[model samples]
Target: MADKPGNQTPNTPDVSESDLREMKVDELREEAREAGVGAVSGMKKEELVKALSEARSGSGGDGSGEGSGSEDDLGAGPDGGKIRRGPESSKSLKYSQEVTSPDEEPEREGRSLVTTHHEVIKEWAEERGGVPATVGGTEHDDHLGVLRFDFGGDDSNLRHVSWDEWFKTFDERQLNFIYQESRTDGNQSTFFRLENPGREDA
Candidate 1:
């Protein structure tokens, strides 16, 4: 059975490829204590693959390939609610690169953000399929940049990357519609991060 957090969410280390390779039953059990292992526990490493398959056989949360909850469930509850909007979502958004602090540069290490984009991301997006995903970037003192994201463009839900490659691009000939995600207001309070913080409406 999966263990639930009881007023405490333990910090789970990132499951590295190296760690997965050498996992033992006892080690897996410990991992379960940290992050519940479910049916994947006690199986020989070889059996791990098959057990994961069984767990996903309508036993886990995601019934559809998309994820756990439905569209209406978005913004409702943290667990079942879909906080991150997908490309196909009607409440999707568009992205534009903005360098906030002049002193802020892209950090290649340390702090990495799991930001989304309007299916317009280039290289990584095209290579990984048109699906929306989070990618890593280097934040530095002089250049803290974000991958531009938005909705509607080339296709019903597609994006464009700028030629600079570091920035997002849109085809001059084609245009549709774009919307940005709304963050909450106030500090310590969860506010939707405005695309351009300097922008007044932002």
Candidate 2:
């Protein structure tokens, strides 16, 4: 007997790899979580798809493959989960390397690095006297909105904030920081941009 069009077994995934690929990274992560694919917070889009596929097929041992470790493997989240990987924002600056730790250095000058590491982000901001900040009047009921870095610029609407506050909001929103250490000419550069891959407008 053939299964009905809308009826499928519990082990059979209704979504396909191509369908998963078309979905945003955040959406993929959510699907992974709902499917009982563990350690998905740090997974990239491809990884999430693979994990989901494996889980659906019931062939992924423990459903903990590569890059599938507890949240502490990367950075601990406020709720003991791994630091999330945001979807690449449309407005994100170009980055050549992905730095997971503060100790990692760029392979060349003017190279852009993307990271969600707290230490790495803090170091990068401090190196150029950048302070955590938020856009004025963008607050939502005591929650900071539109995070930014204040480099002593003339932007009077920027409100300086504590690192704790900034990071709390950062993780809550699942954002990635794109930045460069120097210009292509080897001069100090203050180029940095924050992106929330979870947002359609990000």
TM-score for each model:
0.18, 0.56
> Candidate 1 — worst ten consecutive residues by lDDT sum?
168-177
Whole-model lDDT values for every prediction = 0.28, 0.68
Q: How many collisions per candidate?
A: 28, 0
> Candidate 2: which stretches are off by over 4 Å?
1-95
RMSD in Å for model 1: 17.9
Segments of candidate 1 deviating more than 4 angstroms: 1-11, 40-42, 46-202
Give the number of the best model, judged by lDDT: 2
lDDT digits (tens) for residues 152-193 of candidate 2: 989999999977788889887877778888899998889887
Per-residue lDDT value at 81 in model 2: 26
